[model samples]
Target: MTPSTTHAQHPVGSGFTPASTVDDVLEGIDLTGKNVIITGGHSGLGLVATRALAKAGARVTIGSRDTDRAEQAVSGIGDVEVRQLDLLQPDSIDAFVARYLDSGRPLHILINNAGFPGLGGIVRDARGYEAQFAANHLGHFQLTLGLYPALRAAGGARVVTTTSGAQRVSDILWDDPHFTTGRYDPGLAYPQSKTANVLFTVELDRRWAADGIRAYAPHPGIVPATAFNRSVGEEAQRAMGLIDASGEPVIDPDRGKKTPEQGAATIVFAATSPLLADIGGVYLNNSDISPLDEDPRPVDLTDPDTEVPVDVVPHSIDPRSARRLWELSERLIKSPSA
Candidate 1:
């Protein structure tokens, strides 16, 4: 595909659907010698994916800002390892990367699955970058860049980024990435980071295709419940139609609300499916490719006009924007003391 070729989400006939479970996708597939790393792999969809991959015989490593929390969450789970990786801190990210490099392990799959919910006001990183953008986008950007050698050693590694349907909501605020204008909302910051996820994959694939490193950005769907949703609290979730006032999750088929397993199917599929071996830099949903949203439809949930993502926005996956974000990310992730 050409650099300008914007691929739409077209199913590759992978024989899997949105409702497929992690086991369903991994059936008949073997990953005995493969090695993988997933951040935040002890909870939510990340945990589900971690278990599935380990069950398939892959050596799985989980990175968490709170190693104790991660360890406690997976106390009964066998064969998975957890390490310290605070994405918001430059030193922590560097140390984590250096540790992995020194181990001389060939990383076959890297999943940037950890992210914060977009429900808080702007929280800046040490460099003053907005927290959502810094952690969700810039952090992953730095880690991916740092792990290039291990990815290259694998000769055909895959990087799967967990983006959201929210990518359609906002474009990267290039002039003021830190929300310098001071009007911050979880609604805006979250989508900007998600958009970066998609764009980063695009440019990464374009530049690294020859080296056999492919990348993908997939929305895990509107999961009915996950620890990540705590950002919205009970009242807001009730109003958003995610749950009832009685505290039970509302199972809505049309709105794409899914269980954690079902939501995780697409991520595992994107990571392990043979159908995608030749495909890279595509946006996914339902364990298949999703159609591009040429025209964005904003979900008016609140008075200030917050746009929730229903599809991949054109701007988020645009070649120009992807390249621009790549350059900006390279500059932003550098440590001041360096």
Candidate 2:
């Protein structure tokens, strides 16, 4: 089957607004027997999404690098199970996939929501790929492909990757993806990974629609509570105007931050909405399909006045680039680390 297409991105009048909660998106929908795997469900938006889905009757598994932390986090957040997955390690991803496949369960939903906080410097994986790209893009790429059998067995499935408005600011940095000759900046690496998320959805949808798999990339909105700034440093936050000169977080009403429930709403919407049954590979925000970029200008990540652009950048959804990214990811996954 050819990939389903929608002409433009506008509010579908999803009846759920930017302020809608996860409960709002899930209203009247019963996932009773469905099975879902949410990576990074230990905290932030992923943890909350797990809670909502589990409460709605889906069998939820929280895949994390720290299984103990994940298990403890979700111990009271409905009946969520836990699995081990370190997205930074290919072996860890393989082990996680193998365990899931061994269970003989169909994967109704796969949420690739785990990500690295900006470390403000370059970190490389064993394979010499940029760590952010490896964890946020390549790891999920390998995991999704490894779980293909489970996804196919379900007969129909939805894959939702948590992309960001940051995607609008960057491209793949294809010529020097690992920054060998180019200057290394985690700020650049971070958005580049987000761009990969968008392209991955586009290419995955094109290749797997016939197999009954549909993919979505949703921006969970400006979720400060779930952000990695604390781990990165106050200077980075201060630089972004997220913190004041006194080292206090700036609460700018113009930069509205979503509550955890509100943050998870778009993810739930993308995964379960009947509104999107016929749509695949569309980027979403505020629980609505996002408009394609009419203006493709890149946003500067370091500018205090600059906000993360929510619209899909033109290059992010470019078919040719998406295909190239998919191939690039495959090679990176297969490379032998010296």
Candidate 3:
């Protein structure tokens, strides 16, 4: 896994096919003695992800904004440690790190899995920043850097950030990030945040690869019936055709769309798959490296180019853009800690 060593661009064939569930991906992979942390591991895809990793014998720590929810979710999910953490609050991030540090456990994996979609209306943090951008991008940025030491200590841990196809909508609006001058648009805001996710991974992988800290950002495909979709109301759901006339979601909770187990497969793959031992800074779907221009347009709406033709979507994995985005994000977040 030398930083300069590059593997062929061909897709890494996964044993667990497209229809594979999280458990399928981790069937015989024993993760005993490994310490893993997953943000937003209490609900939706996060919960499913936690279950898979934990079942594989990994010591999982579920970090959440809500302590009660975290406790409830982890209660029967194998041997899991629940810690109260809010990516939005720097102090909470600091506290979570301190507690983990005090425990003297070497962190082996970090999955930045939480995200928010700006749907209902324009919401801002107390700092007057748009909530989606702050929560989805800034929050995880802060948390990752804060936990860098633990990741470094493990020497070869992987950092998997949850990215979305929505990234095609827009890159960060650097000059008007807060939407101060123009009207606030939820649609644009969500896509912008997702784009940041991809760029963040690109930058992080570029810089950290030298130190054995490879980063991956993955498009976990669509979750039309999870907490991730809860933010979008009836109108947005209808527009996406995810809901029915009665206001009930058209997709079944368990079998329809991707089940939570299936939704978490790629995330699990990206985090622990040996297939990616030499892969860094790439965008993945269904455990395979994807084409950089499959979609052509940043947010192309015309039939999406299904490069691999699976539930997972394709994405750009440009190294140069990743480097540039990394620099820009460092400047923007500008945390003294980073």
Q: Best by TM-score, which number?
A: 1
Poorly placed runs, candidate 3 (over 4 Å): 1-10, 243-256, 294-320, 335-338
Q: Least lDDT summed over 10 consecutive residues: which range in candidate 2?
A: 1-10
Whole-model lDDT per candidate: 0.84, 0.84, 0.74
Model 2 accuracy (lDDT, Cα)? 0.84
Per-residue lDDT of model 3, residues 115-192, tens digit only: 776667788765567888878887788778878888888979899999876676666776677688898877789877
Question: What is the clash count of model 2?
Answer: 0
lDDT of 1 at 119: 62
- Using alpha carbons, what is the TM-score of model 2? 0.90
Clashing pairs in 1: 9-289, 9-290
lDDT for predicted candidate 3 compared with the true structure: 0.74
Clashes by residue pair, model 2? none
Q: Between the candidate structures 1 and 2, which one is better when assessed by TM-score? A: 1
lDDT of 3 at 64: 88
Q: What's the TM-score of every candidate structure?
A: 0.93, 0.90, 0.85
